[model samples]
Target: MTTFDLIIIGGGPAGYVGAIRAGQLGMKTAVIEKASMGGMCLNWGCIPSKAFIESAKLFKKVADAKSFGIDGIDKKALKFNWKKAAQRKDRIVMRLVKGVEYLMKKNGVEVINGEAKILDKEHVQVGETKYTCDKMLIATGSRPLRVEYKGIDQSKIMEIDGFFALEEKPECVLVDGGRINACEMALMLRYTGSKVTMVTESDSLIPFLDEEIRKFVMDKIKKAGITVYTKSEITKDAEDGVYVGDNFVECDVILNAKRRRAVLPEMGDLELEMNGHFLKINEYMQTSVPNVYAAGDVTKQFFAQVASAQARTAVNHMNDIKETLDYDKLPVNIYTDPEIAYVGFTEEQLKQKGIDYKVGKFPLSVNGKAMIEGETEGFVKVLSETKYGEVMGVHIVAADATDMIAEAVMAMRLESTVDELARVVHAHPTTSETFMEASYVAADRPVHI
Candidate 1:
């Protein structure tokens, strides 16, 4: 029987990262992955989705050339060659896969290309080969969940995974999910001239965000010409398109964004403390079984961004580092036209926790840069503890808000006070000034409204 010091199952972000770290520590490590390296994020989820979004953004820029003081562009009818777009995305994915392979080789981590089945706590079986390890890590990722409904098995109905495989754009697409993926897809396709409708089972889109921010996102989505349906349940049906609550929504494609569960089919032998379908882990990311760690989407944490953070935290713990994973400071990004990004607690969360807080908001219309760019559609909201003036949360919706949230995340993680943020001078005529102004407002000293 072949053996190693560490064995990692699943080749997604967590598994690959852990494997590399283990290899660097001079541990004999082997990673078993059934599919390509880099898992769903590199292959199908994050990278591919972002590639399509980038193309859509470029298409919009070219179509809206007149707004930039450029004329004589009589290209009225813009077309999307989905085949080439998909090919571009696939090439990028291949490059990333090769990068992971290079990392594994450089770190001296053995790569096993096959499906792994857990034979016991110390043993894993891959076809005819069995390997034992002193330590094991289960980093298997997740897949789109299919809801139990009548016509869900039909060809017209699709999941988020199917978006990459689509050779052509659908006439009208019905997207069901209230979170980031659903809103982003609805906007992307709508911008490309597709009739898009978003149906959410919840009361508002992005229910996890602040209620005010959720309302703002809903309004933006509606203004972008995408129909928004809230408090609706999807029933199964066998039709040419998607049906919502018995109404046959004439859609060429139906994208379901219900939820994702951990992919852990080979975990039958090892006992796990599961929160629903997600493996339960402590702050250290240790599972029910000792020396067996679980991270990323496989754990109860549903946030993809948080999953990567947790993976790093788990690595630190494995190396006997003292740092504990703190979800309180994790930043989240929702990739819409006017992107939404936030860190720390929301106003609602603060109220629910009974923490005395104050909120300050600065609209993008006031920012010179936003007006200059003609993308003024969102705002920055900063929350602080009323007594100490310590920054608690920062939420933003604007161009590059996804990247801007990093500053706020750092502030919250460092426990920076509102006064500290207000003291820092931001560049003139920049979107970053919004954060400075919001902090000023939080501190009750606003220079600009």
Candidate 2:
């Protein structure tokens, strides 16, 4: 098609999702992708990393299986097959990529493959073909940042793609970065028997994490035997080991966590207002130019979930359907050992805003399901406003923390109070029951400590 009602640039979660919604609303949509479909999250970043985590968790389970009555698990005999795990990760990534392609076809959206150059607001040129659309969406996500050091073997430094390309795990691995991917990778490799050491330039490990959750994760990773050093510097002597602030760490490979900036391609003379490195957008996801909208990593929000929602909301606005996302209620999930997920305000944030809040905490060590599964090492903390009893935030650290955080998201979406959640009958003996119990504690009536 030479023309479309809407043309979306970059076929990641943002562009593809917007295309589907636009098609459903009877808009002639076309999505132009320069690289693979499903973006970085589905293809390499999120999906593959989670698959690795699953494998790593299995190793931990096998090591601890003696208590669960699984006999004959010889610790010396157990070995993790890196090739098989990579094969599985690749399989899962491919399946989802195909699914995205299928969705594009089913939704009556044309998928064009090539680098998109925005000729203007109404025109996008991919090679020689100049397609025009009434409105355009910029969903092009970020590119990974490269960190360089004066070293003897620069070949050892690997990005996400490079590390995934390895046939097997490397001995004496030095992990770099302090984000979700870096933390997950360190733990995964440690479980798989790599001598892993982590060093990051950030002041705090996973700076965005809730303080309590951060402390718990720090303790867990230390106990897991992954050496961590923050605010690190690569000191002198390029021959042997890299000194991370005097703690010399020698390794065969350096795996970097994916740190990225909003990387936009050349777009002729079009200028986009920048919010730091990302595009500035309105509440409806519209850019400075009314007809040109942006979402995903190209904009302020980074989470795939936020990007998808922003794109859909932008599509709704284009169709004259006025709707906007709840910015404060957006959930941030981190795939650490066990897991960390939370939505709304952190205690620090609440305190900073001078909001009167009460906290309710329920430890998984006391939960029946957790005790039965022998994964009783986390807790759920609920924070609510004292005056109206409205839920301010919900933080969880558990095997199913990401899954359980959804209920809190829904409650916050509906503006449901803690009293309401406390009153609702949740199925007993599940980790989610902690939510109600935590709410009870917040209400000053604790059934279980």
Candidate 2 C-alpha lDDT tens digits along 159-220: 86456768878978788787777888888889889998888788767887789988888888
Per-structure clash totals for the candidates: 3, 0
Q: Pick the candidate with the highest TM-score.
A: 2
Query: What are the C-alpha RMSDs, in order, of all predicted structures?
Result: 1.7, 1.5
Top-lDDT structure, candidate number: 2
Tell me the TM-score of model 1: 0.95
Write down the lDDT of every candidate, Cα atoms only. 0.85, 0.87
Supply the global lDDT for candidate 2: 0.87
- What TM-score do all the candidates reach, one by one? 0.95, 0.96
Q: Candidate 1: where is the Cα deviation over 4 Å?
A: 151-153, 236-242
